[model samples]
Target: MCKFLQHTGLHQCVPSPAGAAEGTPTTHQWMLRASNSVLMLLPAYHNERVFMLAYWILDLGSKKKKKEKKKKKKKKKKKKKKKKKKKKKKKKKKKKKKKKKKKKKKNNNNNNNNNNNNNNNKKEEEEEEEEETLLKIVPTVVCSGG
Candidate 1:
């Protein structure tokens, strides 16, 4: 039992099967692997030099999973933000187009008003010219006393 415990920690060692109480070294290793798989417990090393192996087993996989999930979330958020930005830009463009149309309509109205004023001024000038022509054509009659 002490030998077994030395090979596997008391907390981690599993009871040997009655059918395979005495097994070869390879068989024991296989049993340990089966036990670990059934128990869902991955082996860990408490040593310094084997730290890289332990780290590879435990740290990298979980860290990669977490990073991937975070990246997916960030990508989703970026897509949403881009969509919102596009909507806002479309709204701004529509507003700008409306403003430009309104300005054009106002300009057209002002141009019409200016044209009407010009027409009125031209009619007044024509009336003045006619009056001058009539005055020039009319002769003053004078009576002389002898």
Candidate 2:
């Protein structure tokens, strides 16, 4: 009875009432009561009730199906090819030669003498003008005194 209950996926078997024989009308009544409660607690679907009733009747003595183990396939590893490296050639740079510039010499004494002569001539002309102005002023003073 317990095995049947387990297979049906219903409530655990209720021990028979003390001194009550198995398969008795009282035990059947208890089972029916429990089943009725389970059905009422479930969603109201006529088809679901029919299916549950059919499953309970049909799969009573059938064994549970065992899950099959899946086999793993072996993967082949690929070989990596080695790449050859190329050698780079070094380039030589040519050095450029620089040309030297020639410098010319200048005679500075001639330029200095010319500048000094022009300055001396200007000074002499200014001294002569000053003497003429002094002579004219002396004559005017003598006339005023007389």
Candidate 3:
């Protein structure tokens, strides 16, 4: 009997009366029967109730989707920043290489100037030695002829 009532979506709150009394003014039994009848014949709620519930659910889903989109946007921004930094680094390295090449060229020019000065000094020394040898040979020949 209880299972049959439950199958019909009716809950038995309390125990039934002692005897099979019909149409008796039993307040607790009336309340129980009224509750059971209410459970069996469920009334549809207002449209506003369903609309409010659906609005909250949809609102929450959109908020979650927005948050995920923001995270993706942030990740994309980070990747862009990283790529920019890499390009900046490469530009700096190229500039440094150009500066080093310029410095090397300057040093080579200075070395060539120094080599030219040394060659000039060696030519002057050779000229002085030839002048000394000619002076000694001319005097010896003049003394021999006298």
Candidate 1 TM-score to native: 0.37
Candidates in order have lDDT scores of: 0.63, 0.45, 0.63
lDDT-based ranking, best first? 3, 1, 2
Best by lDDT: 3
List model 3 lDDT by residue over 1-146, tens digit each: 33333544334444545684433424444333454353333343334543354455556667999999999999999999999999999999999999999999999999999999999999999999999998888654344654
Candidates 2 and 3 compared: the better one by lDDT is 3
Candidate 1's C-alpha runs over 4 A off are: 1-55, 109-146
lDDT of 2 by residue, 40-97 (tens): 5335444554447544633442332211111111111111111111111111111111
lDDT of the structure predicted as candidate 1: 0.63
| TM-score of model number 2 | 0.23
Candidate 2: regions farther than 4 A off? 1-106, 139-146
Candidate 3 segments exceeding 4 Å error? 1-51, 105-146
Tens digits of per-residue lDDT for model 1 on 1-146?
23433455532444554565443233344333444342332344344433343344455557888999999999999999999999999998999999999999999999999999999999999999999999899788786985
TM-score per candidate, in order? Answer: 0.37, 0.23, 0.36
